[model samples]
Target chain A: MRAVAVGQAELKLFWRNRTALFNSLLMPLLLVPVLIAVDASGVPLVIGLVGFALLMAVYYNLVTTFVARREELVLKRLRVGELTDPEILVGAALPSVVIALGQMVLYCLVVAVVTGVDLPSRPWFLLLGVLGGVAIFVLLAAASSAFTRTVEMAQVTSLPILMACLFGSGMMFPLTNLPEVLAKVLQYLPLTPVLQLLNAAWADGPVIKPLTVVAVWIVLGTYAVQKWFRWDPRR
Target chain B: MTAIEVRGLTRRYSGGFEAVRGVSFEVERGEMFALLGTNGAGKTSTVEVVEGLSRPAEGTVRVLGHDPFAERAQVRPRMGVMLQEGGFPPDLTAFEAARMWAGTLTSPRPVDEALEMVDLTHRATVRVKQLSGGERRRLDLALALLGKPEVLFLDEPTTGLDPESRRNTWELIRALLREGVTVLLTTHYLEEAQALADRLAIMHRGRIVAQGTVSEVVDAYPSRISFVPPAGVTLPFVVDAEPSGRVTLRTNSLQSSLHELLAWAHLNNVELSGLDARSASLEEAFLAIAEEAA
Candidate 1:
């Protein structure tokens, strides 16, 4: 209940910042046109857009949000209240999660209209992939914020993951296009399983292997956040 | 009943720097206790421990009979804290910030009432980043009061306020005290402590060097009498003289010392120039502690 309150305030603040809003909401849409121009179609194109939305709106935005709140001492002040550490974090992340999910929905609709593709055969897998991706990315963002000393440093600290997910997670290009050995290696990257789950939503593919991978990343991400997330600003 | 208790509380940072060392004090229910200290005196560190923001490195702190750090949920709802710095989100308006904070409390006062208490109703629509420093401080106070907490912890609550706002804040605090709220305040303002604290502990270099009522702390230091001595006239009592030919006498007995000096001037038919005598004040005592620690 308290988390909802925190989330409401965060949503207001999120909307108030024009630059952040533009970056999170509009910037990722630009990639949709580029993907279309590159002749990417069907499940891969929709999955790519979903991955971009999560990365830009949820992961990147959350990293900066956490770092800025810590430096501003917002997290410290909130701790003085009844909210626990997890409650505070979840509440703060609520706006970005909602935004990313909204973007995912919009992207799916746009792709469906543009490509004249039918609805997914297994919508459950799509839902699971999207929800699981949100949880994993939220935790990863919090954990990444541990290394980010300032809001400016967020750009630097978030780069490695952003690059890894972009190039290796089958977001920009499909794994099938790469060599067999390299494709197998890249499949284990954090976002790859989420993409695999997403692809399975539209067509038949292996589920248990990708499901196990997603579960493993979620566990590791949760552990990392618990172990390293900082509430106070580093002096 | 004791509202707060600390025993041998020590706090150390990651690099082994002890910010607060072996400090202990208690405040009874419906009483105000101030922690006075110089910069780097560990007052904030000690208060943070009691507020359950951090665990003590060496001792225990219990607020309202519960370990504040270990059992925060039991204690936090009953206490309010105004940190030394306002950590409000800059993008939030004063009203929005207060409303949001109120949402987190189990039974918060109305947002309008909190804003009115801090005289921030006029600035409710202004973003925090746009507010003046004093306004920001008042907003911090407003949020702290939203929870209607039983025990309030204020760390330098009036640091950046204008004189009028400072006085108004004092009145608000006094009103809270009158209503039986327990307050634990940490401040660099000696006069504020003297005015508000029922009892205070003076800390220097991470330890309490003195703890007593205001008069008691002031009484520890001697009163002063200073004047320019008439040339070649040996004074009746020993004194410390500066190069400017001014002599100062420190004495616990202010009346007797002044009388003795007046008598000597009359007997010698000598006139004393620039004569000044005053009893010790909290400021004097505070400066003395800082010097002694130095």
Candidate 2:
């Protein structure tokens, strides 16, 4: 309940900053639409939308929240209170995670209505994919934040992961079309299991092989968070 | 029970530079105690250990009779802290931050009440980023005052305040002290220590060099009179003559010293330049101790 209240205020603050809202939302709406127009087959369209969710919900939210808090020293201050260490971190991230979740839902709904695509058949895989994606990105963001000395550094810090996800996550090209060696290598990338799970979950028969891979990635991401997340401003 | 007790509290950074050198002190309940030092004196490190923010590498710290590091929850709800870093979330409004802090405590003062206490009620709606430096300090104070904390840890709470704001904060602190709140304050400002602290410790080179009641420590040093002996003539008392040609008399009795000086000066038919009598001030004791430690 407390996290939700904080999340609501965070969302309001995000909205108040018009330019941040534009950067966070515009990339998805415009990029996905352009991809849909180019393909016209709609398969690439849905994949592009899912990719957008991963970027904003998990990657962007995580990085921005981490950098902002670090610069402000908010995490250090929160540690002195009654809140436990985990609670302090998780609570601060809750707001961004919630925003990410809301954006994903809204994106999916908009894509469905405009493109005439139905909801996923199995839904469980997509559900797990989105939730697991959120967890993965949130953790990765914290890990990435360790390298980020300042909020101005966040843009550069986030670029590598963004580029890696764009090419390696099979959003630009179908995973089945990739060379077997490359496909196997990319399988370990954090976004691969998420996209694979979403794709499998959306298919008529429902493939669940991505479940194990995603679970492993979740563990890896969480380990990184535990090991590298910095609570204090170094300077 | 001691509000705070530290034993061999030392903190060494990862680079092997020791910040706090096994310093320890106990803050009795319901009194204002200050840790005095210039910047980089490790006063912050000592207090942060007591506040349960940093784990001292070698020492043990107890607040309310529970180890702060091992038993954070046990001490957290009972104490309030304003750290050296005024780390406020930029997105948080003053009221929201206060309310969120209030939620953390099992028992807390109402958010508005805390704000009102710090004179931040008018600016409660403003986002933290919009606040002035001193306003942010008040917001920090408001957070520290939440839970009507039994013990408060304040690390340079008046750093950026104007004189009016500083005086107001002092008055507010006095009110809290009257209500029996145990306060532990840290500051570089000497006047702040004299005005508010009943007891204080001065730290230098990561160790406390002096700790006692204001008068107790000062009384240990001789009260002094600084003056230029008129016409370079000798005075009755033994004087520590300075390079500046000003004579300092280290007298045990201030009243008798003053009496003797006035009588002698009248009989000698000379008036001294810049005659100033000082009963051993806390500032003098602070300088002496810090200089000795350094």
Candidate 3:
């Protein structure tokens, strides 16, 4: 209940800043069309775009927000309350996760209509991918924030995962089109399994490997958060 | 009942610097206890331990009969903390921030009431980033008050405020004190300590150098009685007589020194002009201690 209140307040604050609102909404809205234009098909493009949106909204956005809040002492103030450590992190991440999920659904509908792609054959697989992706990215954001000292440093620290996901997660190009060795390597990146699961759901392909890889990422991400998460600003 | 108790509290940083070294003090219920100190004097470190934000390297801290660190859940709900620096998110308006803070507590006062108490109702809609420094301090105060806490910790609450705003804050704190709130505050402003603190401890170099009521602390130093006696009148109790026809006397008891000088003047039918008698001020005492520590 307290987490919901904190999340609502965080959402209000996020939307009030017009620049942040524009960036969060516009990037996904514009990126989906660009991906469709490049691929000339909607299914794979929509999946990649959904993954991309999750990365921006859940991972990058939250990493910066957590860093900024910690530097500003907002996290410290919240810690003084009855709110537990997990409650504070999960609560702050709630708004971004909701935004990403909403954007994913909106993009899927738009892409399906524009490119005449059929609905997913296995919607449950897509749901698993989206939910798992959001959870993984949120945990990664908290883990990343542990190392970020300031908002400026957040920008630099977020780049590696972001760039890795952009290329290796099959957002820009399909993993199958790459060399065999490269495809195998890129498939192990954090967002790869999520994107593959989403694409498989769209195309009715096999889901076993992608599901297993995503579950592995979730476990790894959870462990990272537990090990490295910092609630206070570095002195 | 004691509101706060610290025994041999010490905090040492990783780089071999000890910020607080075996400092101890107690604040009784309904009392205003101030911690006055210079920069890096361990006032903040001590308060942070008492607030349960940090653990003491050694010793114990109890707030309202519970160990603040080991038993924060029992104490935090009834305690309020106002840090010396940024704690509010800069993007939120004052009303939104206060409302959010109110949501965290069990039985918070109304957000509007808290805002009005800090004289921030007019700025309630203003973003924290846009508010002036004094307004920001007021917002911090409002959040601390939102929980309706019984024990309040204010760290330099009026540091950024102008004279008028500072006095307004003092008035609000005084009102809370009247309602039996236990306040523990740290400040570099000696006047503020003297004005609000029922009893205070002055810390220097990680230890308290003076602790008592304002008058008691000031009384530990000598009082001065300076005057120029009439011509041909040798005044008693004159410790120093300069060639410029000025006589100055240092006394532990200003009243007795004044009486002896007046009696001597009356007996000789001579008048003493330009008489001045006053004990040391808190500022003087603080400066003396700080210099001694240095």
Q: Which candidate number maximizes TM-score?
A: 1
* Candidate 3 residue spans exceeding 4 A from truth: A37-40, A149-153, A200-216, A219-235, B227-248, B263-273
lDDT of every model, 2 decimals: 0.91, 0.80, 0.86
Kindly give the stretch of ten consecutive residues in candidate 3 chain A with the minimal lDDT sum: A32-41
Alpha-carbon shift of residue B121 in model 2 (angstroms)? 1.9
DockQ for each candidate?
A: 0.81, 0.59, 0.61
* Full-model lDDT, candidate 2: 0.80
Return the number of clashes found in candidate 1: 0
Interface Cα root-mean-square deviation for all models:
0.9, 2.3, 1.4
Best candidate, DockQ: 1
Q: After superposition, how far is residue A52 of candidate 3 from its true place, in Å?
A: 0.7
Chain B TM-score, all predictions listed: 0.96, 0.92, 0.90
B238 Cα displacement, candidate 2 (Å)? 6.3
Candidate 3, A152-231: lDDT as tens digits: 78779999999999878778877788999999999888898888788778676668888888889889998998888887
- The CA lDDT at A226 in model 1 is 87
Residue-wise C-alpha lDDT for candidate 3, range B1-294, written one tens digit per residue? 999999999998879799999998999999999999999898988898999977899989999999988898899889988988757888888899888888878889999999999999999989888999999999989988988899999999998899999999999999999999999999999999988999999999899889999998999887878778767765554356789788878788888877877887788878778888888889888988888889
Name the candidate, 2 or 3, with the larger DockQ value: 3
Candidate 1, residues A121-188: lDDT per residue as tens digits?
99899888888888889999999999999998998999999999988998777778999999998888
DockQ of 2: 0.59
